[model samples]
Target: MHVAEEQKPAKKSSKVKWIILLLVLLLLAGGGAGAYWWFFLRQPPAQAEQAATEADKNATKGAGKTDTAKSEGRLTTLPPFLVNLADPAGRRYLKLSMDVEVNAPAAVKEIEGQTAKVRDAIILLLSGKSYTELAAPEGKLLLKNEVADRLNQILGAPRVTRVYFTEFVIQ
Candidate 1:
């Protein structure tokens, strides 16, 4: 009876040791994952703040420039677009708003005048895209280029220099 009691305690201790080791391993794995996310996956707010400050300074500097020079780097924001993605489920949707930068200020007025056509073209493009296509950074960069091309086609010239997505949401 004494030997049996001793064996039972040994078994219990072994099990406790295994559980403690598993918990430690789990804690270590969780800490590594958290550190990876903090260092890699998270966007730095400080960089964005610095960019904003730089833009403000640029605007201040450009204040003294002539109207044509000031308008040369003008940007025109388009209306938000909501469209269902071309996924098999058909339930996925994307909502997007973007600002288009033109090479000259005159192109801004052209874009505004042709807003309906621009929206139509963009809506069709967005609706045709699958969720997978716009989910990656490379895909987004391609989308920007395509958008600029489409805008240029509508404007009958390569007036658009860049497209900046101000809002992008997928649901």
Candidate 2:
């Protein structure tokens, strides 16, 4: 029958549309999963653990071998800094704890020797920032770079290559 033929084509078209829609949805889900893995899970847990172990060994062993530390990198932890932000309300404060990555172990000793000066410089810089200035990700990154530059200046060498904020809190 003519009507039956028309109904069959309509049913086929409807099924095709559903199949296409399902495929599109599957593609979108796959893309989202891929992006999540790329951003958050790119580093495997085993690799991170191994790197941490290596860092510990380097820290302990390179304390006496500046050449080894210089060849690679050394992480030096700094005492946490708690400073009042230069906000209009004067009610905000930031508590930050970080590790400085230096090119040499001598830089670590230099930082330890100049702890007072280093703390002073960092405190001043941190206190000069307003709450809004350090609230965004870009602002935090800028602060990290600025802190590295300041540390290098204090050390009188371009030793401080990176600053990793282990704990950052602004309130």
Candidate 3:
């Protein structure tokens, strides 16, 4: 009977220990989630406002996109551009076809109205890059971003959301 009583106490103590361990684990998980929310999920106020503005633009009519895509934006295809790379050793060229995503119909009209200036800017930008500068995937992304940034500046707003290199060939 004494041995039985002692065993009961031991079992109760072990259960308490187990409950404590489970609580600690739960606390750790909750803290991790909180940190993730703070660090990764939260956006700066300026960026949040920008995103909200873009969403408003997307919801407007005459965005030139299907239902699903119009919820985000629209794409406008640029004429294919072929430029000789700044290769000194030999002749190297890049033929690139691209599309730009615009925020709204006003942006599209602005882009269309400045097609000549846009093309000239792109041609100058592309013709300055050598084959080595554009051979890698990262290089292409940088080029796309630069074009978007430049176009946005010329258009006097953040109208261009993204640039797509639909076709890229180097020789």
RMSD (Cα, Å) of model 1:
8.9
**Model 3, runs deviating above 4 Å:** 1-71
lDDT of 2 by residue, 22-112 (tens): 9999999999999999889887889889889888777877788544333557999999999999999999999999999998888999999
> lDDT at 154 for candidate 3?
89
lDDT of 3 by residue, 74-105 (tens): 88999999999999975899999999999897
| Per-residue lDDT of candidate 1, residues 1-171 (tens digit) | 988989998999999999999999999999999999999987699987987877876897788844334444678999999999999999999999999899887899999999899999999999999999999999899999999999999999999999999999999
Q: After superposition, how far is residue 105 of candidate 1 from its true place, in Å?
A: 1.1
* RMSD per model, one decimal: 8.9, 6.7, 7.3
lDDT for model 3, on a 0 to 1 scale?
0.90
Pull out the clashing pairs in model 2: none
Model 1 misplaced stretches (Cα beyond 4 Å): 1-72
Q: How does each model score on lDDT?
A: 0.92, 0.92, 0.90
TM-score of 2: 0.65
Residue-pair clashes per candidate, as listed?
Answer: 0, 0, 0
Which of candidates 1 and 2 is the stronger one according to lDDT?
A: 2
